[model samples]
Target: MAEVVTSGAVARTVEDLSGPRGLPVVGNLPALVRGGRPHRTLEEWCDRFGPTFRMSMGRTPAVVTADPAVIARIHRQRPDDFQRSAHVSGVIDELGGHGVFTAEGDEWRRLRKMATQALNMAYLRQYFSTITLVTDRLKRRWDAAAESGRAVDVLDDLMRYTLDVTSGLAMGHDLNSLEQTGDGLHRRLPLLFPEIGRRINAPVPYRRRVRLPRDRRLDATVREIDALVRDRFAEAARRMEGGGEPANFLEALVAPLEGESPITHDEVFGNVLTMLLAGEDTTSSTAAWAVHYLAGHPEAQRRVRAEADEVLGEHAFPPDPAAVGRMKYAEAVVTEAQRLRPVAPYIATQPLHDVTFETEQGPLLVEKGTPIFSLHAYGARRDTVRFPDPEAFRPERWLEGALPPESLPFAPFGGGPRFCPGRNLAVVEATIVVATACRGFDLEPDHSAGPVGERASFTAFPVNLRVRLSARR
Candidate 1:
């Protein structure tokens, strides 16, 4: 591991870091374009340049690292000395605007406090019934596919399931995106995150200057989402006027506090959008990948099913927190799946001041505005130095008695203060969904749609993931 020099020491320069110096004007853009996925390209660069290196995005200087120590240090300094890169935050601002996810400094602190209160353990406990209801809808959808003996698009179903859960938890309403068809809001929600990702990585700020067809559609979609959220806020406000306590996240945000000023209407709208984007894509992607892994690994599947049977007995319909807690192996399975395929593949941060970054090679100086990309998925799961047989799915790695060392690179939900607050909810939701689905049916991958590949949208998710369900006795 690279050692950080003492505070007063001179910082290193970009020339000191190991990385390819591409064309004069374009820098690494051509290579990135040729390499397809940015994370994979960066991972390959890590292999060649050791754990830390320098790269460029157009004229902007960037540093890429997969070193856990370096990533931990960066995360620890978040919002103080290290903040979300301007490019990343700019994209999110355009999509969701100044919510908890995109806010920084005092604003971020305030939003985080409110959001954490709304999504805390107590609130999560209240969400179990809602989760169960959503899962029941998913079960019925899968059952129909099972009876038809046709492969179902698991990713699509899982996305719908998550959307339903998020809607119920965030707004106390049931969009029924899973059961309903041709819902404009449901269709548009998925596009928002991917478009944000596209704009963030685009070579030019084309959308800023002109509204292309896709940009026009995205604008319309965002307006629709805004209208829906605004209506929910109004409804919640009316209910509060009638002396009702807050029932959902929207209400929680807008409900008056004894001391603090009430959150503005715009804040409520922004945070609601944040919740939907954060909750839907990340949870669904992780669950779908877990299903994919379980489908391919029958032994693991059997173990999870057996564990689910013991924990859930004959009533696995609404997985209560207690029941989900008891399914240790099932939790391990989900953890392992997340280890292999983290939904949010990277964490991007920028230093607030000149900083010395510890790396495998040595301590390197990073300029204040340079974007630093920590490849979380690759670092935690695929690094040969940390995880043995990095490519294999081994749930035992996360079992209670067999857990890996805490120091090992295992950041599925990031690290430090910036760690995802929704992690517990995501894990619990995935565990319930996976255990329930596996208990009810055996899954077989439909590889005829071509190999199960990963596509990087707002989250990394399984692409072409079709699975045939065989009802279990």
Candidate 2:
């Protein structure tokens, strides 16, 4: 309904997507590098030039969209037109061939379908105890610190919780990551995961040409994790052969799919590695943001605690999935937190074939091989058309239906068919973690650091968060 701005009238140097660029080959690489976080800069571009816009990341042409309709059409209606970027695809291939997250085409489809079975509505119930167990452990750690009259590094503790939950789901066994120490195999896995993502995204020639020190370390870590996963799969296979009950995701995956390899040894390893890496960091970051925001908003925190008390009552953690579902305010808090701080800020997609589509605004024609990125979590949220007073944290907006569900206005978990399969798990994990923490812990913002900010790595996390926590009075 509002007039969309164009690059001609705007002061920015990058070429606009709406019109043919009158620019040179070097493209916007220099400007992109100077802009610091690329997602924020892309958001600025969307603000200046409607939802669909363009820029060049090096010689590669990139189209960015904030409009939900455009994103949906691109991902659902015209999915065949798009493919994972070569950079991302190559990285995945190197990590593990055709793992669900990395694989495309039939390989991705089949693997995703199989993976979903483990994470489906039915299997999720099995994780309730694990989530509660891990969160309860974290609460005790925080309580111990409170008794000692010491400040807690909430980030570190939350990561421990995430690692424990991830290990439980992936391996059918808890690693007690919250109590883990030493630079041994268990610790190396989490450390290497995000660093691999960073290395993959890094524009380093040495990433492909020669092994950097970190690369070698990452390779060694992957091998170690692979061995662990292989051993687990072998044990599961033996148990299944001996007629044992299925207990974890690894077992489900290893179980047969009539026409397919139930799960290859590498597939098992890849899935385990994928789950461990993705599960921990993203949820941990979401939990971190949840604590940060609630601490800053006492009234909201009180409401969250009140709901937790009613739903979970006297329990140290959320009771069960059914009970967790009843805590609407808890869900809203996590949603709002994620809306403000999505872990994966921006995602890149390249088209396998040229495509054209029509929208309420106008027609879009993306040439074959063009790299398009959707800034799903940035200005898209703060955009007035998408969310009113978008900068403010108001959990009630969701209850009030201030924003439409179909709107791509806030895609912390992304949009379309490619929308994150793990989103449901993430929501559940965040709600329980935040609600339980508020019930027993008094978290205060670390004012000494001025304000907690972030560095966009594989996931966006608090760059230097130092918060003080004490027992709830």
Instruction: Give the candidate number with the greatest lDDT.
Output: 1
Model 2 residue 435 distance off true place after TM-score fit, in angstroms: 0.9
Candidate 1 lowest-lDDT run of ten: 1-10
Error of 2 at 122 (Å): 1.6
Clashes of 2: 0
Off by over 4 Å in 1: 1-11, 33-35, 256-258, 382-386, 404-408
TM per candidate comes to 0.94, 0.90
Query: Stretches of candidate 2 above 4 Å error?
Result: 1-27, 33-36, 359-361, 401-406
Tens-place lDDT per residue, model 1, 102-121, is 88898888888888887877
**What local lDDT score does residue 277 receive in model 2, on the 0 to 100 scale?**
73
The candidate that wins on TM-score is 1
